[model samples]
Target: MAILTPGKPPRATSRSRSDARTRFSDRASAWLNHPMADIVLVLTASGLLLALGSIMVWSASTVFSYTQFSDAFYFMRRHLVFLGVALVAGWVTSRIPVDRLRGLGWLVFSVAGLLLALTFTPLGYGVGGNNNWLNLGGANSMLRVQPAEFAKLAIVVWGSAVLANKRRLLDQPKHLLVPFLPFSLLLIGLVVLQHDLGTAILLGGLVVAVLWCVGAPLRVLGTLAVLIAGALGTLVLANRSRVDRILGFLNPGSDLTGINHQPMQALYGLATGGWWGVGLGSSRQKWGSLAEAHTDYVLAIIGEELGLVGTLVVLLLFVILGYAGVRIALRSSTFFGRLVAAGVTSWIMMQALVNVMVVLGLLPVLGVPLPLVSYGGSALLANVMALGVLVACARDEPDAKAWLKRRATLRSKAPKRRFSAVLPGRS
Candidate 1:
């Protein structure tokens, strides 16, 4: 009997494959075990904002709901519904791999682009002098979608992908200006057509910020800035209402009865509240003195109710959110994550700043809301989802999540057993 030689080839291949699998498993396990406190901080703050917004929206919109919808809690109910939806979106989005979002840049932007193009169709509706909403399917029985919101996200997602991919070559006009500028212009054109000047400015700002963050050359940014200014000037001239607003902005007292009514009312609302505020849910402005109290001018209502302290708190939250987001972006393992996180951070922070400024009369009324602190289903939902992404990014860091987890574990462990059960009979 001869002893057969072992199959060295198969054995060698098996060993090599096993070693490779073990190495891959080790890396995967290490990542999962990492702490994620940054994600928790962002999520906690965002959740708090949403909750506060719900209360404020109810306080701000109840009067209008009674007068316009014949229900005392119409807007409040609607806002709660939107909050639910947004939470779901946030949860779903957080579970998604951050890498998948990078590939989605074009598709997301394209859909949003189509929606923007549809604004000219009969389905588009002009409201409060802005042609921004699209009544898809029909005017009577259909969803009125705001393409601008989606467009904002698309720009963040897609623009970040581009800037990230072109990290080194963005200095070249052929790479940066040609491809980036045209699409941005196209989107900007749609927004301007909607007469949403503020959002257009915001989107423009985000693109520039994201580009610069990715290290695009200063000259390229300067050129884009000049182009944006020229384009804005042209748009302002072409639109008479926009011109009127600009003129009114320069001299708010010039037309107290007409164009300046909203700002005047907002100022009046803030002035009447004084230091401690008129108390929550007792605002006089929400009774129709200030238009869009829950949507565009909720901060005025906040001022009238929560006072300067309240406004300051709102500002501080934004500052904190901004600071946290930028930190997460800096700490991100991937370029896309950094850009996307930074882009989202910039979007919300800028919008919140713009809204507060408008409410405070530092800027023209741009109709931008205070993120989760304002009332609007679309606005709340989008913002909440954006926060979820920020949370996921923060979760990548070990120290932050680890600290939170340790604290949480300690809390759970320190608690006593159920009293009734422990006492042996109350159940």
Candidate 2:
């Protein structure tokens, strides 16, 4: 036995700390493995992101909104309206039977296709050099819609249904490529014609996701990947603006005021944010230094206002969402559910990755917005609705369904009481 020094505290051992961490990890893993965990996690994460997004959008768009519309809350009000619509869509989608969605695959696909075709009519107009918006009313109206955004959802639903139905035949190239390839190619071609390469890439990725979920042959997947890469390269080279962006990404110092301006300002915002950030709604860059502060560079504003901690929170929420999505896919009882879960997971995660990478200057600016967090009405609607679908798939899991049924039975069997029972009036 050793004598302890007077008034001196014993030091905590490294082994003790390690043991504590292990115990916490075990607890977390066990909780997350529960039958209801996926649905809970999805709802929690999605809700937090939506709330944070609304706050950040208002913060980032104030200056721009005031400058253009004379009302500082203009963008924020419009964003709230879109959020309301998205929430309604999500609620409706979550209530839809997963199997019914499979039957609706073709109809949804047809509607998306028709909308895309409408983008070629006189009602279509270009924004930021991408002719992807269809104006329902005059130019001054706020009814502009992006068909490509909806096409992303359509591809997931339709592709999953088709692949699941032909699951056994996916081994053969003919069965795999016949209708799926032609339809997907048509959609991508339409998007490309609208000059929306980013959405086009997302659509192509959805195809790969569905095929992979159905266990397409490795050779077939490899060939498709190569073709997609080649097509992307060709498209990049064909656009002079895209070429300049690539150059700017490679040599950021070469063009400080042109292609590199927005990205450089974004970096400055991030750098200024430091660790804790400058504080919410206190970003210096959003005052007009950063372009598209409410849309493309909203992440930068988040960084500037909330600091690295804020940005990390956003990233963590997405990771949680992705984890729940993948878990749902794995636990889903049907092939259609699996494909939809995987496809939507890949789509949202990939898009978020691209947006983050662009803000971090790791990739050229591709004009893609952060999902669920960006200020675009169409993107927000599509994302939340996809998440609702994901939640429905989660609920379709055998374990989740049983758990839900048990809860429902318990509630129904419980005795009902009137408000008078709790009041002093009567029993």
Candidate 1 colliding pairs = 36-401, 37-400, 37-401
Off by over 4 Å in 2: 1-19, 419-427
Residue 331 in model 1: shift from native, Å? 0.4
Give the true-structure RMSD of model 1. Answer: 16.8
Candidate 2 per-residue lDDT over residues 1-427, each given as its tens digit: 5467899976767998999999999999999888989999999999999999999999999999999989999999989999999999999999898999999999989999999999999989999899999999884676879999999999999888887788888778999887888899999999999999888988898888777877878898899999999999999999898898888899999879888999999999999999999999899998888979999999999999999999999999999999989999999999899999999999899999999999999988888999999999999999999999999999999998999999999999999986633667655
Using TM-score as the measure, the top candidate is 2
* Candidate 1 structure quality by residue, lDDT tens digits, 1-427: 5455787433356778899999999996675444553564576677777777888999998888999878889888878887888899988877666778777788878998998888888878887878888876553332567788878788888887776777677667688665666887789878987888888998898788877777777888898899889988998899888889889999989898888899989998888778879999999988878878998888888888988888777777777778779889988878888888998998998888888788888887777888998887667777887887777667655465567678889999896876543556654
Model 1 weakest 10-residue run by lDDT: 136-145
lDDT of each: 0.80, 0.92
The whole-model C-alpha lDDT of candidate 2 against the native structure comes to: 0.92
Instruction: Report residue 16 deviation for candidate 2 (angstroms).
Output: 4.7
